[model samples]
Target: MSQPQAGRGTFITFEGIDGSGKSTQARLLAEHLRAQGHDVILTREPGGSPGAEEIRALVLQGDPDRWSAETEILLFTAARRDHLERTINPALAVGKIVVCDRFADSTRMYQGLSRGDLRATVDQLHSLMIGREPDLTVLIDMDPDTGHARAKSRQTAEERFEDFGANLQAQMRAGFLSLAQEFPERFRIIDGARAIDSVATDVAQTVSTHLSSVG
Candidate 1:
């Protein structure tokens, strides 16, 4: 992990293909940071704020082909705008670290790469509408096959995204890795294939190091 300048609230996000345990790790890291006496808010994307959550259901449920890739991107961007204004920005303004399960990066990978070759459009929309990035993005890297197996075990209406299958997961993994390379300063690529505790410990240590540097 690398150091970031202190003096403001930290924004951290966990990203990976579905079933990579990003949600669990996000929760663990939040609890760890809270126990250490830091103000922390753990949230997720496409649905962080109330309005975003409604969008979450709209995007995650229904038929797999409910919305075209471009339209889907719009919905996600709209939800993200709501989330940033109502949830993320407010917490950061109050000097509280925000641990989000997913952020714009997921949109970059899921809609940008996996769903279709819409990376250019995704980037354009992000730059125009949501230009913020996390202070630290912990990417839980793992094999797509493992992620697919794990995702299958937990059935939900959100299966729409998961229906992309293993091939897309592989593409998403590579997309995330590319993001890590592009933003080395704030991206922490963790080996998510390891045991839960091991990965948790590594994530916690990375967060602690960044906090120490910034604090």
Candidate 2:
């Protein structure tokens, strides 16, 4: 089902809808690990690597109309390949624990939920193409509509994905929750409606527990 699909070191991912507080909490997790004197690498999908970042702008800013879902998937996979080869894998090779804000999971939920057909193949490719997954994933689950509002409240200007409808966002949220259910050991879903520190604490604890188990 996966290509090689295995590797050295632990990969940790952060997932959620637009306003799920994943980025902030992912940083907190990385900091917490570093405080424990563990090496931690922080990165993100579709952008962390230089090449990936270039593609990121195209995917995020390019006209969604001119692009087919298949085209979008290929672009994302291309970025992922660049990210893994240039950034993620190298960091892992050095034995550092990586805390990534989004990864293959983002692809699954966003692309899967948006497309009406050929969804399963995209899902299959996501799991199969990537050779590594986070040893733990902290999903900040929230109502996509509320999440969109929250995201808008924070941003000065919205990105392309952020401009989508509540319905699409809801489907994405459903996709994320379904993914969590399928990978019990890999996902730790956290309530994201509370204050930031409260959410951070939950994320920190989950990372702590996963790290302890690994150690």
Candidate 3:
């Protein structure tokens, strides 16, 4: 889909390695913004709208080898397209802030970093199908060991990605940081090892600063 027109709304996405508290932080930021009197919609990738949720199960479940990295990229892009069409675009069109837990970035980190050679393919597919990006991406940065420990504590069918273990998490963390460097204007990297409330406070401040600058 094409990028939203200027002033349509602000799109914010939370991105990080698994267990980096990005999901929780995304939710908290949504609540914080709502309290500030902004209309906000809290959503997630791979499963924001109904059609994409069905795609979510297909990509996230089954064996790790269920799909090749290249195929997985297609699935994620398809899901993202559906999500943008059915949920995100509508929310943004109405001038509501859309806070997403993950976006095309996750596809880049997971498919690109894991598969190594497919990173270029990921970028091309993203440009072809999911060209738009969040106006702000809050990347919660943390050590891989800590992230793995926290991720292991949470049991879910979505353990597929976490199964790659700490080494991959470390690599993905590096990949995420590199992405932040590549997209400095749109990225706000936050130290996620601090207390939850502390991270949330910083996130709020960051969003406030971006909003003010945009206004």
* Top TM-score hit: 3
Question: What's each prediction's TM-score?
Answer: 0.94, 0.90, 0.96
Cα RMSD of predicted structure 3: 1.6
What are the lDDT figures for the candidates, one per model? 0.89, 0.80, 0.90
Which candidate should be chosen as best, given lDDT against the real structure? 3
* Candidate 1 clashes between residue pairs 3 or more apart in a chain or in different chains: none
Candidate 2 local lDDT, 16-126, one digit each (tens): 998878898888878878998988889987788999999888877734464677778888888887788777888777788888899888877777557656568676766
Q: If the candidates were sorted by their TM-score against the true structure, best first, what order would they fall in? A: 3, 1, 2
- Candidate 1 has its poorest 10 consecutive residues by lDDT at 1-10
Residue runs of model 3 more than 4 Å from their true location after superposition: 1-7
- Candidate 2 local Cα displacement, residue 203, angstroms: 1.1
- Candidate 2: clashing pairs of residues: 11-134
Error of model 3, residue 138, in angstroms: 0.4
Ranking by lDDT: 3, 1, 2
TM-score head-to-head 2 vs 3, winner:
3
